[model samples]
Structures are given as C-alpha cells and as structure tokens.
Target: MRRFDSAQPILAGLVSAVVGYASSFTVVLAGLRAVGATPAQAASGLLALCAGIAATAVFLALRFRMPISIAWSTPGAALLVATGHVQGGWPAAVGAFLVCAALIVVAGLSPWLGRAIAAIPRPIAGAMLAGVILSLCTAPVRAVVDVPALAIPVVLAWAVLTRFARQWAVPGALLAAVVAIAVRGVHLTGVSIAPAAVLTVPTFNLPALISIAVPLFLVTMAAQNVPGMAVMATYGYTPPLRGVLVTTGLASAFAAPFGGHALNLAAITAALTAGPDTHPDPRRRWVATAALGAGQLTLGLGAGLAMALVLLSPPVLVIAVAGLALLSALGASLASAVTDPSGREAAVVTFVVTASGTTILNIGPAFWGLVAGGLTALLLYRRTRPSSPPDPTPPSPAATELPSPTAAGPAASR
Candidate 1:
C-alpha cells in the first residue's frame, strides 16, 4: 500500500505525457512537412521536441519543486500548417523559430515587451488563433469527402470515444488510422526506426520572420504560456514567470536547429499533474512532472518509428486524425473570439482573413489578419463617456480576494 501510494504521482505524470504527446504529434509532423521539411527532418524535429520537453520539465520541476509541465506549441504547429512553405524553405522557418525564441527571452527580461503582448486584447488574440487553425480543423470533412473508406473509420472512432472517453479519443483515432493503413496493404520498406537528429543551418529572411515568427510567438504566449500559468495558479502554485520564459525560450532555441518549432507551458495537460488528483499532497506533485519527463524521453526514442508510420499511411487519414485532435481547441478559440460584443467585428474580420489563406507581399494571412483586425477596432470601436460621475466606494475584502480552487473552473484547453 505504501509503495502504491508513492507511485500515484508518477503514474499521473506518465499519463499526462502520453496524453499530451499522442494527442497532437501528427500536427507537429504535418506542420514540419508543411514548412518544407523532408521526412527525415520532420522525424528529427519530433525527436528534438521530445528531448526539449523532457529536459525542461524535469529541470523545472526539480529546480522549483513545483509541477511545471512543458509542451511543444500545438497551436503554433497549426499556424505552421496554415502558413505553409515560406521563403528559404525549412531553413528559413528554422531561423524564424530561433527568432521567436529570442523574442520569448526578451519578453521575459523586458517588462515592456511583455506588456505589449498582454496589451493585445484577448478577443483579438483568440480570433487570430481561430483563423490560423480554421483550415486544419476542416481537414476531417475534406478527408471524408476525398477518401471516405479510410477517413470514415478514423472519424467514427474519434467521435465514439470522444462521447464516452474524451481523453482517449485522439489516441483511438490514431490507432484506427494505423489499422486502416495496415488493411490498405501499405508496406513500410527501408524505414529507419532509430532516432537521429539532423541539423539545418538556419537562414534569416524577412518573409519567414513576418509570416512565421511573429504569429508563432503570439500563439505560443497567448494560447499556451499565459493559460498554463493561470492553470497552475488556480491550483495554488505560482510559477516564476521570468525563469519559465527564459528556460523554455532557451530550450526552443537549442532545438530550432534540429527543426523543432517551439516549446511552452502546458495548459490543457497541466491539470493532470498540478491538480490534487495527481496526489493528495501538493508538495509531492513535482514528482509527477519528473515522471512526465521520463515518459517524454521514452517517447522520444520512438520518434523514428512514429514518423515512419505517418509517412507510410495515407496523408488524408493522418490529417483526419490531426483535425479531430484540434476540434476542441477550435471550439474554445471561437468562443473566446466572439465573447466580447465590442470586439466581435474585429474578431470576425481576423477570422475571415486568416481562413481565406490570402498572401500579400509574400507574407501569410495570419500577420495580415492582426493588421486588419487592429485597424477595424481602431476605426469602429469608440468608448463613450459615462452619463454620471464615478462611484468612490471601496470594494469589500471578499470582493478583492481570489476565488477558491473549487470556484476557479477548468483552465482553457489548448
């Protein structure tokens, strides 16, 4: 009983890592490919991400004695898929990754930059993210229309499991995709199962920086890091903002040469390890994140095999799985996008431009979406003066106090 009790947090950590990796790895691979990485490079990118996640999670958990879960930026991957190939191809994209990493570090050191990011209204940020992922979210329906025989089984598996076992739905869909590939008689020949890292010398170009780096930075910060902090805070943990930003930014920089795009705080999966469900005592929760690091290291060893399976399968089927995985994120983004009446028009404009996949002056629609939305808000949104003077009464202590954990509600799913 003692041994089993001690192992609970470890098991929770492992579960969190598995769920995080399985749910969105296809998106990572697809994003790498979209940015012109070859099969080998994409596999390398996956391996690099796994290594970074493992190293950073373990280091932070141990250093802070807190459950600080780290993850590859899923929405950033979706943004990559939307942006497609850019100038200087994979190398340029890599350069953008490094540039974004520097920006993250700068944001940590410079309060002004951090404030600038925070100044972007939540609705606008949410709308931009919604636009970025809209196309990829539609891939499932397109897959069914284009390849029903393979796509239908995957969709049905995801749907059924989503209704009954939401956490396992994406993994179940991936399993269905694998079975479909086998049934289709697709043979994997000359596939390398050993993980290997291939480094590409990054080339900086204006187009990739504007198109990929800025949007990727915004999505990572708004969608992942900020919410991750809130999730931890909800559970009564205060992670050091500067340390986390610098650590993850450095990790991302180290992995960029190997094709990994970005790494940030884990929002959705943070609950698994940070909440009391992982362990009755909050002090022991860090052990669970350390176990998560071990699990990610184990998964990193199989990156080559995972890449091989993805490469051998029908593209649409894999895409269908990626689409299903992102459905929840899309729903949450859309909800946040239109929640404020004042920002509704700007958010809608952002979403439409992003979804349209337009490119002007060799820059992707995501950057343009922000520009259009900001302009729309500037021209249309006007603050009216109050009809009377403001009240001067001070708030009660209870009103100023933070909510209890039970009342904090669940963190936004990434």
Candidate 2:
C-alpha cells in the first residue's frame, strides 16, 4: 500500500505523457508534411519535438518543484496544415520556425512584447484558432465518407471510449486506427525503426515568414502557453513564466533545424499531472511531470516507428484520428470566439476568413483573418463610442436600499 501510494504521481505523469503524445501526433505529422517536409524530415521533426518536450518538462519540474508540463504546439500544427506549402519549401518553413522561437524568447525577455501579445483580443485569437482548425476538425466526417472500412471503427472506438473513459478516447481511436491499417495490409518494406535526425539548412523568405512564422507564433502563444499558465493557476501552482518561455524557446530553436516547429507549455496535459487527482498533496505533483519526462523520452525513441506507421497507413485514417483529437479544442474555441456580444461580429469575421483558407499577396488566411477581425473591431467600437460621458447621477434611496433579510431568501438567512 505504501509503495503503491508513492507511485501514484509517477503513474499519473506517465499517463499524461501517453495521452498527450497519442492525442495529436498525427496532427504534427500532417502539418509537417503539408508544409513540405519529406517522410524522413517529418519523422525527424517528431523525434526532435519529443526530445524537446521531455527535456523541458523534466528540467522545469525539477528546477521549480512544480508540475510544469511541456508539449509541442498542437494548434500550431493544425495551423500549418491550413497554411499548406510555403514558397521556399521545408527549409523556408524551418527558417520560419527559427523566427518563431526567437519571438518567443523575445516575448519572455521583453515585457512590452509580452504585453503586446496579451493585447491581441481574446475573441479574435479564439476565432482565428477556430478557423484554422475547422477543416482539420471535419476530416473525420470526410474519412467516414471516403474510407468507411477504416474510419468507422476508429470513430466508434473514440465515441464509445469518450462516453466511458474520456481521457483515453483519442488514444483508443489511434489504436483502432492502427488495427484497421494492419488488417488492411500496408507495405512497410524500407521503413526504419531506429531514431535519427535529418538536418535542413534553413533559408529565410518573406512569404514563409509571413505565411508560417507569424501565425504559428500567435497560435502557440494564445492557444498553448497562455492556457498552460491558467491551468497551473487553477491547480494553485504559479508557473515560472520567464523561465518557461526562455527554456521552451531555446529548445524549439535547437530542434528547428531538425524540423520541429515549436514547443510550448502544456495546457490539457498539465491538468492531468498538476491537478489534485494526480496527488492528494499538491507539493508532490511535480513528480508526475518528472515522470512524464521519462515517458516522453521513451516514446521519443520510437518516433521512427510511429512515423513509419503513419506513413504506411491510409492517409484518410490518420487524418480522421487527428480530426477526432481536435474536436474538443474546436468546440471550446468556437464557444470562446462568440461568447462576448460586443466582439461577436469581429470574431465571426475572423472565423469566416480563416475557414475560407484563402491566401493574399503570398500570406496565409490566418494572418488575413486577424487583420480583418481587428479592422472590424476597430470600426464597430469607434462607431459605438459615446461622444460624451454619461452623467454620474446619484441613486435614489429606494433603489439603493437593501432588501429585508427575509426577502433576501433562505440562503441569506443561513
């Protein structure tokens, strides 16, 4: 009993890592591929991301003695898929990755830049995220129509497990996808399981920078890092913001040449390790994230195998799993995008433009969406502003008077 009790946090950490990795790896792979990474380069990117996430999680957890979970930016990956191929190919995308990492570092070092990011209106941010992921989120439905034999079982498994074991739903779906792929028989003749990294000489181009780097940075900061801090706060833990941003930024830089796009603080997975459910004593929760590091390291060793499986499997099946993984995020983003009546129009404009996936002047839709939303918000707000301040009238005695204790209701009496 004593041994099992001590192992709880460790087990929770492992579970968190597994859930985090299995949930959206396909999104990462698809994103890398869509941006022009070859199969080997994409596999390398996955490996690099796993390594960066593991190193960051373990170091932060131990150094801070807090459950500071780290993760690859999943929404950023979805944004990549939406952006599609860049002008300068994989190397240019890599340069964009480097630029994003530098921006993250600067955001940490410069208070003004951090504030600027925070100043990006929440509704616009949420709407942009929603739009970027809209198509990917619909891939499961498309998969059902295109490949029922492979897709149906995966969806059913995810749906059933979501009803009973919510955290395991995506992993279960991934497992089902693997089973379906194996049964369907895929050729894996020359695929290698040994982990390896492929270096690309990064080249900078205006198109890639505007199309990929800027939007990727925005999505990662808004969707992952900010929410990650909020999750820690919810668990009564104050993360080391400067340390986290700098460390993750540096790690992302290290992995960028190997094709990893970005790494950031984990939000959804952080809750698994940081919450009271992981350990009754809050102080012990850091052990869970430490264990998560180990789990990620172990998984990193198998990146080649994972990528091989993904490459060999039917494209629609893997895409369907990625779509299923993002459904919850999409729902949350949409809700947040339209939650405030004042910002609803701007948010809707952002969403429509982003979902359209149109490019103008070589820049992607995500950037244009923000521009449109920001302009709409400015116009609407300026038009609605009062010409003069309202008079500060005093309240009447009757209006200001408190209700009787009895009239206040039963709870008030108690």
Candidate 3:
C-alpha cells in the first residue's frame, strides 16, 4: 500500500528538497570557506548539514505527526559570509557552532528564553532578515552586469518559468545556469570526487562565540524558526516549539564537527509541503515531509558531487543563481516589514543598519539592527501614542436583563 493515497504530497516533498538544496548550498559553501574551512572540509560540512537536517526533519515529522519541515540556516550562512575570518579560524568556528547549538538547546528547554525570543517584534525580525539577505538579492544584477552572456539566459529562464510554474523558477534558473556554464567550457579539472568527513577539534574562543554563535542563534530563531512556525500555523498544524528547537539544535551540534553551522525549522520550503496544494487532507501531509527528508538524505550522499559541480563554476555564476533564488524571499520580507505604519520607521532603520554591514564592539550588524529598531520603535511610538481606557469585560447572560420566561408562557397568554 502507498504511504499516501495522493501522490501530490510526495511530489511536493521532492520538489521542496530540490529547491531548498539548490537554492542556498552555494551560500553555505561560501560561508564555510570564509570562516576558514578548506575546500575539502567545506564539502564535508555541506554534506553534514544536509544529512543532519534530513534526519531532524524526518524525526520531527514522525514525532509530531505533522508536516514540519526542517532546514539549514541560510541567514546564518550569510552572516558567516559577512563576518569572514574570525580570530581562531575554522576550529574556532566549530567551537562557535557548538555554542550556537547549545544556545538553541537552552532556548528549547527554557521557557523564559523561548518567550524572550518570541517577544521580538515581527517588524524588527522581518527587517533584520531583509537586511541580511540584501547583498545576496543583489547578486543577479551584479552578475548580469559582470557577465551578461552567462547571466542573461539564466535570468530569462527564471522569468519565464516563474510566469508558468512559480514553484520551479529557481531550479529552472539553476538548470539554465548549468547549461550556460557548460557551453562556456568551464573546466572541471582538479575537482575532487572523494567525499571525506574532516573533523575539526573545536577550540573555544570568546570572540568567536560572541560574534558568530550569538548572531547565528538569533538569526536562526528570528529569521527561520519563528517564521517557520508561522508557516505551519497557516496550515493549522501547530507543532510543539520546544521539540522542534531541540531536535534541530541537537542535529546542528552533531554536524558541527564536520562543518555544518546550524539547522532549524524551514520557512520557505515548508509552504510547499504544508499548503493545501500538497494534499486535500492535512492529516496525511506528514508523508510529504517524510519524502522531503528522504530526498534531502539522498542529496546529502552526493555532497561530493555537489561540491565538485560548484567548484567547476565561476563564483559570479554561483552567486547569481543564489540571488535569483532569494529574490522572492527578499521581496516578501520587505513587504511584510513595511506593511504596518506603526513599525515602518523602525523596520526601515533595522534594514538599513543591518544592510550597511556595520560591526560594533565585534558584534555584527544583524544584532545591532534588532537593537536599534526595537529602541527606535519604543521611542517613536511612545511619544505619539495617546492613552486609552482598558476594555471592559462583557456581561454574562445571568447578569443581563432579559424577558421573564413566565411572561411568554402559554398559561399567561391564555
């Protein structure tokens, strides 16, 4: 018997995995390299991330009996890319990764921490995410300007595909990019096919912990996990927040020694599996998420191949494809951040400061963006707001005046 009566769910799952993987793996690779991972180690890290998230997604879906999709922290990867070289190199980065995982675990176990994270204003969160992805979203334009011949076809393909099959746009663009790269005779020489797990003995560094781990944890929670829960809620499936957090945290820790930075609830791809289009019956959508996990696992096994393929491409091409993938996410975040008049200024401030790439006291722009936005919002809104009376509770039926039953009785009428 088929696990799911409808194949739509299964198909949706497969597509989610493909789109998710193809979209952001380059960013992961670039981030790992920036943090001092050798090419071989970076490949191992990518594989470990895929495997860890795959396992986490499967476990969470089965445990919760919901379509809870898990994903690597793309925003966190972008953070790492922005941070570049740290004080202790890759070993220190590994230590920071472990710290991030531990923090996530604590957030899961401690109600106070979870509440604190949840208390973050939605506008600030959206703006911070938008800022983080701003650079990435510009890659398409830069790539086109830098290499028109290679980028134009990919962009055109994405535009055409998006018009028809919106879901397949990114992957379609990626296919076009691959063809463009191949036609240009990009050499594949010197690319290694061997997939080896390179373990880094983590070295504790306070600077790395403060800079990388703190920002990573914040971004993963605010940008990915929080919105991920919203996505699930949209489909009326509310999985336990703690369980999801703990599962992804442990997975991130497990993969850290081999190069993975962080894993969390997936926001973008979750829609593919959780939406009504996946299946008419929401109860059976877990099968689609499971299929997604299986697909991710299969791709994880081919991490070496993925690494080789990426290595063969020019950096511009890789980033351009990645930019195309993130355009939708960027647009959505911007729209959401400024949708409300109350928070518009704060959100814009957050977006500008974060996108500015400013670092203060060794902390990155993302952290500062949230702080500035929150403070600005508090100050701005408090000054202009008028005092209002508290709403009164409604009267109970027994307390309210009503027509007496005796007055309407048949005996009285007679």
For 265-348, candidate 1 gives per-residue lDDT tens digits of 999889999999899989999999999999998998888988998888778777778888898999999999877655676778
TM-score of each: 0.92, 0.93, 0.87
Candidate 3's residue-wise lDDT over 139-224, tens digit each? 88988999999899989999998999887888888888888888998776778767778898999877788778987998899889
Indicate which candidate wins on lDDT: 2
Task: Supply candidate 1's per-residue lDDT for 160.
Answer: 96
Q: Which stretches of candidate 2 lie over 4 Å from their true place?
A: 386-414
lDDT (Cα, tens digit) per residue for candidate 2, span 333-368: 998887665677778999999999999988899999
Evaluate model 3: give its lDDT: 0.83
Model 3: weakest 10-residue lDDT segment is: 405-414
**Each candidate: RMSD:** 6.7, 7.0, 10.6
Local error of candidate 1 at residue 152 (angstroms): 1.5
Query: Candidate 1: lDDT over CA atoms?
Result: 0.89
- Identify the superior model by TM-score, candidate 1 or candidate 3: 1
Worst 10 residues of 2 by lDDT: 405-414
